[model samples]
Target chain A: MNNERILLVSRPKGTPAMSDFRYEEAAVPELKGDQVLVKTIYLSVDPYMRGRMNDTKSYVPPFELNEVISGGIVGQVVQSLSSDLAEGDFVIGNLPWQKYNVVNDISVRKLDSNIAPLSANLGVLGMTGLTAYFGLLDIGKPQEGETVVVSGAAGAVGTIVGQIAKIKGARVVGIAGSEEKTAYLKNELGFDEVINYKTDNVFEALKAACPGGVDVYFDNVGGEISDAVLRLLNHGARIPVCGQIALYNLEKMDVGPRIQSQLLINSALMKGFIVSDYAAHFEEGAMELAKWLMEGKLSYKENIVEGFENTIDAFLGLFKGENTGKQLVKVAEPENV
Target chain B: MNNERILLVSRPKGTPAMSDFRYEEAAVPELKGDQVLVKTIYLSVDPYMRGRMNDTKSYVPPFELNEVISGGIVGQVVQSLSSDLAEGDFVIGNLPWQKYNVVNDISVRKLDSNIAPLSANLGVLGMTGLTAYFGLLDIGKPQEGETVVVSGAAGAVGTIVGQIAKIKGARVVGIAGSEEKTAYLKNELGFDEVINYKTDNVFEALKAACPGGVDVYFDNVGGEISDAVLRLLNHGARIPVCGQIALYNLEKMDVGPRIQSQLLINSALMKGFIVSDYAAHFEEGAMELAKWLMEGKLSYKENIVEGFENTIDAFLGLFKGENTGKQLVKVAEPENV
Candidate 1:
């Protein structure tokens, strides 16, 4: 079968450009023993992918040059040699940026679409949800009536984080890039206060918003926003750093005001964690998040760009703050649906 | 009785100067109900006192101007009007920088000099010891075979921290400002490695010393030393920030490389703490530390300056890195001794 795929042609110096990726056609080989042939339905474009694009020692290995950029992909099984997976089944796996993939059954998990929308598994009920779940509850540990400040509040993880803090009876304050994004967080997500960081003096706005001082900070976009929040921390404050989208694209080292003294004076705690770090408790986290969704206590949004060709554009748009929620590309639709 | 006291005549802009303190003579008033007149024996000159000197928000309130600068003082009960303490009893309390102080009986704790030397209560067996105990064991929970790096390794708290980490079965590396301090740490304290940050390129030296990577960092000195340590952190490294002596004298805001991204990528934990945070468990910490001391598993040193007139000079020498261990002023000798 003919397969369309995108390969990383060059490493980005700062923000990635279109020339960095090369779209081409390739051939997919026949499935062998215990192997399954899957056609890509939806491909996720996340900020974390940017880290893997750089050749650095991080939690995950960097993407190889002239190779298909790989990430979370939802696909439909067209052919299966393994008894574990059946034809016409929908599954999700960390797969390449390609139209068709030949994989072993262990590489993908079968998904039941009756539980929620197929795309929701890529977002609110998936890695994004779990990232917010464990980072906030396990690390941030927001107490009732305490104030929680969330950066990147309109993004997938940040939206879930703010909602979870609210569910735990905290006063949620969100920091976002645009007025429209901040409005969405306050209006739809029940954020008690929202700061447009692009337009507002973040330090003053945050000080005004958190009158009692910030007790828990869920940091998604680190940099100046984090520095300002560090200054206003209450005694024994907790900061769970899940992402640093603000510094991911920088070509040079990131420099700013040091935080050790502030943390020292406030007696605060800051921890960094990835979703897979809590893989053993994934069932518990996902079940609780799903229950919240079923009870109408949680809300989520997705920015879906149609066609496989827009995947690069969708991924690049994340740095520009163009997406209000989980951003994904629709490579194809389930044939059964 | 005649009392000689030093008062904070003015606040220092950057580094404290002699003009900031005023020494004067005052009369000790008659003891009230349950009050005791205590004569100062040894005065603790700690790095944390620098924070209290500034009129800013911190864990402790700033010292009032034109008033006696109060801190840790070991005194002897000269006259007692209460049953809690008696004449000739050696006691310790947070008291003013005065030769004699009249305080309520509840303010001081009677020290049993038979168990250990009186000065040990101010250095190895007192608040300084407790600070090292809780901050290391609770926050920087170093596991066996891991590399534990300590900054300000020859200081009171840092010395104890290195000893405790060694007791916990971790390999200990100490960073100090002088060759003499590093030699003391390596030769006397049995540190696995010692980095003389004064003469060495700290980043390169640390890299060579910790070939495996730093697992637990007990940071008593922050700034560039911490930045270098942060770069070489192993995954899930723990940092307990007990003090920031490096930035204590800065007149302007401290600017350096932001650490959130590094923390995010490594999944590490950094917590700032004071000894009092674990107040409820003080007895447990003190007991364990005392056991180590009694077993000869721990060793401590103190830089004692004789005479009350040298008290200000002794405190000022801390910023200049003049002391080898716990810095104290011997205001008077014990009558019995």
Candidate 2:
């Protein structure tokens, strides 16, 4: 079968553009023992993928030019050589932005749609959900009555972070890019306060919203937003940094707010977290998030575009602040045959 | 009795000069109920005193111009008016830079010289010791088989930090000002390695020492030294900031070694801690530290200058890096009694 794939054409200079990706058609190879042929159904386009596009040293390696730009995907098994994953099985795996993938079963996990929608597994029950859950509970340690301030609150991870903080009984303040996103955080996600960062003076608004100073700061959008929150952190504040979307788009020293002195004076506890770091704790985190989600105690939304060809556009949405929640590409409907 | 005192005279414009203080003699204070007329025996010289000298907001209040500078002191009870303390009792308490003080008995804690030595109560066995213990364990949380790096390694608090990290089965590396101090950390204090910040490229030396990348960073000194260490942190690293001796004397804005971006990429944690924040857990921390002292599992040194009049010289030694361990002014010898 012919497979359509998105390959990294070049390393982005700044704000990863659609031109950096090249769409092409390739031949699907035969599955080896213990390998399953996965037909991509829902391919996730996340901000972290931007990190892999750069050759700079980080937690993970950069994606090579001319290679398929890889990421997590919810796929249907069209052919399987391994008994562990039979053909027709719906699985979630690191299947990349592709129409088809010949991958090992070990890298794939079967998801039951009856338990929750399979796509919900990609949005809230997958890495994104685990990221918010563990990062908050383990790092943020949100206690009831404490205030949690999250930047990028309208984004996928930020939305769930606010919800998780809400479930933990902490007061939540969300900072987003637009009026619409700010309203969504307050009315739909139950954030105690919402700051339209693009419109308001973030420092003054955050100070007024979290008058007592924040106990937990979940930083998704770093830079000036982080600097503003840093100034308002109470002594012994915990900052769980999961993303730095603001800095990810820098061409050269894009300066807004410098936070070094504020970091020293506030004496804030700033810790960065990658979801994979808590792999051992994922099961516990997922189960709790799943329970809260099923009970209607949690709410989530997605910005999913249709077609594999549109994967680059979905990935590029992060920098523009265009996508409200987990941005995914629904490449195809699940095939039963 | 005549009371001799050194008044603040005037707050220093920047780095304090001897001219900022003036010596004067007056009648000894008369004792009141629950009060004791104590003779200043050891006038403690510490970095935190710099905060008090400045007319600005800080953890403690600034010293008023023309008032005797307040500091931690080892004093002898000269005349007692309370049952809690008595004459000839050597104690550690807050006292002014004066020959005598009419202090409340409740304000001082009696020192048991037999536990180690009376002078140690002013250094390692006192506030500095508790600061190192609580900050490292409570905030830094060094675990076994980890690489623990401590800045200001020759200072009172930094010395204990290296030893405690060693006790926890960590490889300890310390950063100090002089070769003598560096040698003392490796040979005398038993630190695995020590870097002399005066002559070495601190960042390069740090990279060489901690090839595995730093795990627990107990920082008594902040600034570029911290910036250097921040870059070398492994994922899941912890930085417990107790003090910033380097920034204490900063005349202007820093020009180099920016660190915030490095911290974000490392997924490391940097936290600030005032020892008193964990005062509730201090009794328990002090108990363990005392055991380490008695078992010969810990070692400390002091840079003691004789005479109460020499307190300014002792304070100046901190900036000069003249003291090897805890720096103190031995105000009055017991023979005077």
Candidate 3:
């Protein structure tokens, strides 16, 4: 058997370029005890991956130089040596950007294809969904009739966040980069108001949109858009920061107006968190998300780029706001299916 | 009887000047139903008062122009017609900065002069103490073996915050503007580390002091100092912003390195709050604080200036970082005492 994997050849400077990644071919090794030979079906590309590419100390360690980049990947078990997993079973794990992965059966969890699509396990029913779930519900805690302003409102987490806030009876206001995103959020996702940050004066637009002031701000794309939303925060506002896509590619330290004073005066809360922080309650979150989806109360979209070769492009496109929702790369299909 | 009061004659542009305040004399009116004529003993002048001085909305409404300035005042009941208060009883209330005030009996709470000094009710046992108590325990939640860093270590809230952090068995590091403040925090308060922010390279000093990174940052002075503390935050660090004394006097918008990225990468929490946010739990906090003080686990200091004439000067000195602890003006000694 053969395997091809993308390696981080060099660290990115400013914006990541194609030259930073290198694809190499290798022979797939035979499976050992408890090991399963899995073929990649779909790979998730997220804004947070950009941070791991840099050699810096963060909640998660930086990806090593010349190492295979790993993220949320859903694969099918082609060969198994453990009772926990069986041949032809679809599983999801934090796996490398490779055509084939030889991992222990315990490393991947078997997925129920009947619950949702195989790819949805890597998205809406997966980490992205859980990120929005815990960040919004646990931290943001939007109350009934309160206003919720979400940045990256058309992205994977944002879309889910807006729906969840709506479910909680909050007036949803979304800020996105394009008119298409703004329209989708307002029309499809039931966002009460949408601001096109790229074209609109975000500060003015936000002020106009949130007449009662923002009670909860679900921040995914931090920067100027966040600054505008922060200024209009109501007293006792909650801000759950899940991502900072805007600052991820910057080569130098990013500077802007300090937020502490605004937070101080408003008696607001701003918390930053990764999805895995709530690993203890992931089952509870995933169950609720699945229930919402099954009931038609939740919807998710995926910008699926076909083939393994386009993975880098899919990942890089996240910074450019190319994807409306979860960005994924389809490498192969389930052999048994 | 004659009464002298200081009024906010004009709105201050940046730092408050003496001209912004005007002294007015009025006749002390006769006590009406349930009214008490209270003579001011000690009036607190806090940094947060600067925010109220501006004609801008905050947690508390801005001080109305041409109206008498008001804040935490510890006074003695000189003449009472109500059953709640009697002659010579010490009381505290949010009252006008006047030599004598005729207010409804329900407006003031009687203080137990036996439990602590009457002045302590306005400092370590009152709003200032409650601010530190709730801001630290509720928001910061400093754990044993964690590093707790507090700015404005010599000020009213900071002093109590350090003591509380120490009580929780956390390693306390204090940041203040002078050697005297640093020495006091380290030598008298038993702070594990103290950084003289004015003379030291705060970033480097803090880094050296907190080798394990900051776990709880009680931010009283926001600006470059906060930026530096924010950078060294450990994962899940909690910051309770009590005040922004450093930016209180700024004429223009203050800008610095945006903090969301750092907070995100660390999965940290930064919340801004005033003492009144925990109003419902005041008795619990005040009881615990009193217990700590009686057990000799807590100590406080007050920089009390003499006479009603210097009230404006005392308030102005807060912007200059002039007072080491709770800044107050002794309007008059208790009439009965």
Highest lDDT scorer: 1
List per-model TM-scores for chain B: 0.99, 0.95, 0.99
lDDT of each: 0.93, 0.83, 0.93
Which 10-residue window in model 3 chain A sums to the lowest lDDT?
Answer: A328-337
Ten residues in sequence with the least summed lDDT for candidate 1 chain A: A328-337
Model 1 lDDT tens row, A177-208: 99899999999999999999999999999999
Question: Which docking class does model 2 fall in?
Answer: acceptable
lDDT of 3 at B171: 99
**What is the Cα-based TM-score of model 1?**
0.99
Once fitted onto the true fold, the runs of candidate 3 whose alpha carbons sit more than 4 angstroms away are none
lDDT per residue for candidate 2 within B76-125, as digits (tens), equals: 88889989887888887888888788888888888886898777887778
Give me the runs in candidate 1 sitting further than 4 Å from their true place: none
Cα deviation of B284, candidate 3, in Å:
1.3
